[model samples]
Target chain A: MRSMYKSSLIACIVLISVLASYSFAMAAKKVELVVWDLQGYSDQQWYKNANKAFMEKHPNIKLEFEPHEGVPARPKFISAVRTGNAPDVGILNLYWVKDFAMNGWIQPLDPLIEPETRADFFDGFLDYASYDGKLYGLFTETGVATVLYRKDLFAEAGINPPKLLEAWDFEEFAEAAKKLTKDVDGDGKIDIWGIGISGSRTGGGGPTTFTQFPFFWALGGELIDEDGWPAFNSEAGLASLQLYHDLVYKHGVSPRESYSYTWDDIARGFSAGQYAMALLHNTHAPNMDKQFPGQVGAMLYPVPEHGITSATTAGGWIYSILTDDPAKQQAAWEYVSWMLSPEVMKSMCADIGGLPTRRSVFDDTMFASDWNQVFGRQLEGAHMKPGDPIFPLIQDEFAVAIQEVMMNQKDPATALDDAERNVVQRAKATDILK
Target chain B: MERKSGSLKQGWPYILMILPTFLLLGLVTFYPALYNIWLSFRNESLRTTVSSFVGLANYRRVLSDPFFWGALGRTVIYMIASLVLRVVLGLALALVLNIPQRGRSVARTAILLPWVLSEIIVTAMWLWILDHRTGLLNGLLATVKLGPYGWLVYPGMAMGTIVMVSLWKNLAFSFLLLFAALQQIPLDLYDSGKIDGCSSGGLIRYITLPLIRPTVTIVTIMVSISAFGQFSLVYSLTGGGPLRSTELVGLYMYQQAFNFLDIGYGAAIAMVIFLINIALSLVYYYALRSESLY
Candidate 1:
């Protein structure tokens, strides 16, 4: 009996030792987290430093970074998710959050993130990254549309540019544009245009919508109504379209070639002194300033007469996790948290000349500049693109309407009507609207 | 049955030798084609989780859409215009290059530069050259006191400008094929024509034209097929924009498939494009078929 009891005790000890060793080995095992980032991240110093620090902090988690260009990355990411070959994490345009979440291509980060961490993000950004009350991702940086104008041209024209937080009414803005347009050479040709707008259909008319939606919204235009139907063909919508048309044809202040301009074209043209003013994203403010010191200024978009309020569109990239494995999910969450932390966010935004999504990052000195403050104030009233999966189709139609009206192919009312009809048809067909 | 079995047994080695290629083609080419056709019959979209069989719905949608028809019309116009310019200019340049002259080799290489360039690079270069406000062409025109024109911005000019650029890029392709055919023509025939007091034009009309007729037909079919399916150039340059003035069928199909995530409808459009391509090839083959030379 004594020998048998001794044997049982030894056996129990052996089993416990075996289980503890197994658990330790599993805990120490390296988990490789694959991350797909927009192309050029590999070359950015901030990105490299963040990766180095992340790996140093989490020695057991290995990160595999794959760089892909934005244009081709969308379809490639979708294809990867469908084929079960998706990376552990991916950085996507904030507009894709709803679509991706709805399709179950990305997992919600709410479970992985703490409430305090979630609350640190700006309300607009959190809303942009959420769908159906679940937080799907966190924004990396933020962009808001503002009027980037030439300060020198404004001074030369004897027109005072609007203050940082101030805005111009439609009439004042149009008058200033007209005054700034000049034929300096006196060759019977206007050498410098007053303003430039992007009406290109690229990105499903993303540039047009991004820069022009503010005007529409300033007049109380709602892109998607309470009933989840497109309502951009209302009175406010017509007025906004007319404003764009008049700027080009009636006022003759904007270039007719605005119909083909992309966002980059507007930025480059503004830097080259082709236009006195340009309605562009504030992200271009830093680069423009760097190229031409103290020559560029930014302000809130102009409002129409009796306009409800001034508004601008906000957009940015969001980091999302696509993995189903718990270990990989945890690692991805750690990476996202580290990236979104105030220290990292501030450094990255400063390096890239972008606005940080976290509210705490605004406390930094870099964002206290007058130009940055202009964008920072605009963020207060900025609108995000609707999160509906069918919004892309609606945006495309809106692009067509903008082009048609600006090019004089159709009147404002008719253009809006046509676009509304198309959006409705597409929405109903997709079952997004009944 | 025994005789067939015997033949199969005799042919087994050849079949074994070609089996890998057949398998690869079946996997890569035939499978995707069949799957795309299958996808056309269903209501498949990236946005939706459930894919149900909705036979003929996608096809009906594509067929009834006015935009599809408009894009088709534009594509046809683009194809015809580019094809004509490519053929006429290709023949002219090939003739010029065929003449033995100083730096003829250098000239041929320089002419082939555009053809060898990637479509995206070519589009980017032309976009810079044709930009309305900051284009090299407009800048040059300004120096001469000429007016700056909206080469790519105007709806009326966008399609024509794209065609012109397309011609510049692809002229070398047709030129090379015709030039190769010119090289193969018998020198004796041309010499005889010359001895018979034939002018240069007469010699080319009789000997060169007839001898290169077959190659021209092949080049036409090839260029037509390429022009019909053009996507990267137009998509990158104009994005079928300026009020859909340059929206070709391929770009429309791409927008529906990738942009809108309506894969089923895009597949239907793709199938239609494939059928059109096959029909075009057949028409060109039969209409331009050459008789055998003795």
Candidate 2:
């Protein structure tokens, strides 16, 4: 019995040493970086290819991916941040960057971007990522709004495409819409609509806001002054709203159903030949191309009458690092730098249907051939929203104004007046008027 | 003194038996409630780990905010509409089901089907059925030469649609309770009422209502509580859209806490909601208690 006990103790000692050595060996292997995002659409195994190549170069490192839907992702990410369990890297909208940066949730990335590499990115792209004179995130892609139309339906109506459709004023746009609204099959009810502009709750609020900006900008209506005081109550602003109100109520070219359409609905409605035109984001076009072949074409938003140039809103997703761990931060910086490489960006734009934020990527022959040129065209005239803590509140107020006017809850003049007053009051209370 | 000491010794075993339940209750319920109350005083944000105490500022902001009042008012309206409809409809159906008829069991099962289905699935089904263009409701209306109407988009109709969904999903519990109450109504009372020349309406108005008043009151309270805290149906259906017409307190709280990452403000709103619900329930209980006494 003594001998048996001695043998068992020796075996136990051996097991412990072996387990310790195994754990040490495993720990010595390269660290894995986690990138969490919600953009889940994968085209023809492109991300898989990118991952394979990336892994081959960094054989010791691994990429961990977590995809989530929009509604649940917010809560999950907030919980993760609250518990100090955020991923090493994340993809978030540009509007979210300021909020995250102001709260110090994300790290400043200026130190990560070497001087030599800074020249590779577009200036506008770089500017969008910087806040308070510090870079906190890098834009993976840029998106701009455009009007997508069905070529077949346009041809069927015997209506020639408007000359410089991308630069047409409001009156020109309305005229084209009216010409396109005919019942081709002689059905008393209208089967095809002239335009599909979303005023609905489910619709992409960004695009709705984007689609409205040109009118305001063209009329020289400013949301804020040089010192950032509320300035949207100007005459130009009211005129812009008057046009939006007229688009739905007076001209009657846009569909009545548009009040409930989201980005997906508008895209799907256009693809299904229900509407002739849609105020759409460039990112949605590639997917629509796949879903409905050779049916759609895109143009930059129309210029406003008496405006110097056409304007559209430019927005996109950015990669933000959420950790302060030196090792993880180093790994994340490497991943981010690699992801922003011109070749990698081209692949991402092609694979994920996002626009490349770098101007150099526009030279790729693939963009011209792959129908991504629309993003290039739209980005040339895109505008960035003023980054502020009050931006989301402003967005909400703007959306409310749109609903009020579109739903006929109030007249255009009254709605704009109310919005201007409310925004001013909110700004005063929040000390944002400065 | 000897007997009292013996009783104290016996009480120790009972305490030991109740200890686990008390521990579980404290761990799960009491701890979070206390923690949340503490959190409401701090400027906790999703962006940072460090938080500072802001005292009643969160409550001040929440109370003064227009959206809060809008959501609260909408929630009250929704609660009243859904509670009334659920109780009335559930009682009517239970009364019908209590009659001696063929396939009564099958009918009861069919009526409870919506309650058994997942809330998300039920919301999705209603979403399709309420779609302005391709919805079954609109389609049927069109076939009958009635004009198609927007069921979910129109602001006046949005709350009605939500109330309908809440009623459909929650009425089954009330029905079951009322069915049991009906079965316990003592058949001889109805026979005596008939001999006294009481009409069916008079019998139900007097005998049935008075007898089942307590069960009905309980059902009303339960339905009111459920409706007051509605989250899933509104979230899935409208997302508080078309200009925040359908925004409920639960959704507003969620947006404030999760989307805006303002936990302190969110918590303040939550506490306010909790207080209001307690007050409302107490008032309801008192009114019922008085009615029962009379």
Candidate 3:
């Protein structure tokens, strides 16, 4: 009996030792997580540092980054997702969240995000990242449309730049633009234009939409009705369209060439001293100041006389996990959460000249500077683009309408009507209206 | 019957040797073409999860759309204009280089430079040179007190500017083909023409032109097809705008497929374009055949 008892004890000890070794080997195995980021974003010191720190903390996970640049990345990502070769995580524009979510290309973050962490983000940012009551991603940075003007030009024209958060009415803004337009060399040509607005259809109408939506929003224009039908052809829409038309044609403050300007053109023209004012994102505030110190100023967009309130369009990039593997999803969430932590968010926003999406990051001292304060305050009234799959089509039609009105191909109301009809047709064709 | 059986046995290895290549061609080329045709008859969109057959719907919609017609018209204009310029300019350059001259080899290499450059690089370089505000061309014009012109901003000028830039990029290709054809023409034929007291223009009109007819036909067809499907340069330059002024059918198809996610509609447009291409090729071949008879 004693010999049999000793044999059982030995068997149990060997089994426990084998299981412990197996667990250790499994824990030591490294997982590779593929990450896709915008080309420039990955090069930032803050991004690099955060990545290094995350890898250091999570020794069992390895990060492999593939950086994509410019407009082609969108189609490339779509193709990758369809082909089942997408990275574990990807950064997408906020407006793409809904489309991606609806197509089931990205997994929801609800299971991964804690309630406290979700509450940390600014109020509307999470809404921008959500579709059909589930958060699909996390917005890391935000930007609002602001009037970036040349302070020296305004001073020379004997015009006081609008104070921070103080917006001018449409008439006052038009007069200021007219005053700023001048032929500096007196060569019987206007060397300097008043304002520059992007009218190009690049980015699938994103640049034009981002820069011009403020006018429509300030006039209480709704892009679509509750049923996701075209609704921007109303009086507010016509008024906004007329405002842009008059700026270029009637007031002669903006140039006819404004019809071809992209966001790049607007920025380059403003920097080259060709335009006294430009409708640019607030992210340009830092660069403008650094390039022409004390010569630049920022203000909220102008509103119509009967405008509801001064409003601007807010847009940004969001990070979402695209992998269906539970292990990789957890790893991706860890990286995303680490990137959005207060310390990393503050550093990234400060370095990249973008507004942080987190409310806590706004309390940082770096965001308390004069220009940051201006943009930060602007964020308070900013409205995100609608999280609808059909929004891109709407933006495209709106851009066409703007171009038509500016080019005198059609009157404001007529152009809006055409655009509305086109959008409705597209919505129906895509079965989004049904 | 025994001899025929022996011949078949002898040919079996050769057929086996070429089978893999035929299989690869079918996989890469024919398969996609057939799939695209099938897709054109369906309602497949990236926006929706479900795909279903919608026979003639996509085609009918494309036929009714004014934008499609406008794009097709622009494409024909672009193709014809670019083809004529490339052929005429290419022939002129090829003739000039055919002469025995100093640094002829250097000139040949220099002429080929634009053709060798990547399309994206060429587009970027031209974009900077033609920029309205800060382009090299405008800056040069500024130095002479010439007024700044909106080369790309004005819808009236954008198409013309794109054509000029396209010519610059592709002129080398036509030049290379024509030059090679000129080389293949027997020198004795030219010498005989010279001995017959033919002038320089007469020699080219008779001997040079007749001998290079086949090459010219091939070059014309190739250039037409490429010009018809031109997308990258114009897309990068103007994106079919200042107001759809440069919206060629190819760009319109791309916008429909990728930008708007209307895959079925884009495929239908592709089929239409394919039919147009076939018609154009047949017309070119028959016209050149009649000329050859003369």
TM-score of each: 0.95, 0.87, 0.95
| Stretches > 4 Å off in candidate 1 | A305-308, B1-19, B194-202, B292-294
Q: Candidate 2 lDDT, tens digit per residue, B1-294?
A: 999999989899998999999999999999989988998998776545578888898788887988799999999999888878888899999999989999999999988999899999998898779877667899899888885787788888888988888877888999999999999988999999999999999999889988888887688777777777788888888878767889999988887776556677788888998888888877777766525522
Expressed as tens digits, the lDDT of each residue in A1-434 for candidate 1 is 99999999999999999999999999899999999998856788998899899999999999998988875467778878888899999999877778888888899888899988888888878877788899899989988898988888888889998766788899999999999999999988888899988889887898889999998888888888777778888988899889999999999998887888899899989888888989998878888888779888887788876333568998888899999999899999999899888989888888888899887888688889888888888888788888787688789999999999888889999998999999888877756677
Q: Mind giving the per-residue lDDT tens digits that candidate 1 earns over B140-245?
A: 9989988588888888888999999999888889999999998898789988998999999998887888788888888889898888888988888888988899
Q: Give me the displacement of residue A226 in model 2, in angstroms.
A: 4.5
Better of 1 and 3 by TM-score: 1
Which residue pairs overlap in candidate 1's backbone?
Answer: none
List the candidates ranked by DockQ, beginning with the highest.
Answer: 1, 3, 2
lDDT of 3 by residue, A147-231 (tens): 9889899989999977666778999999999999999998778888999988898767888988888888888889989877878
Docking class of 3: medium
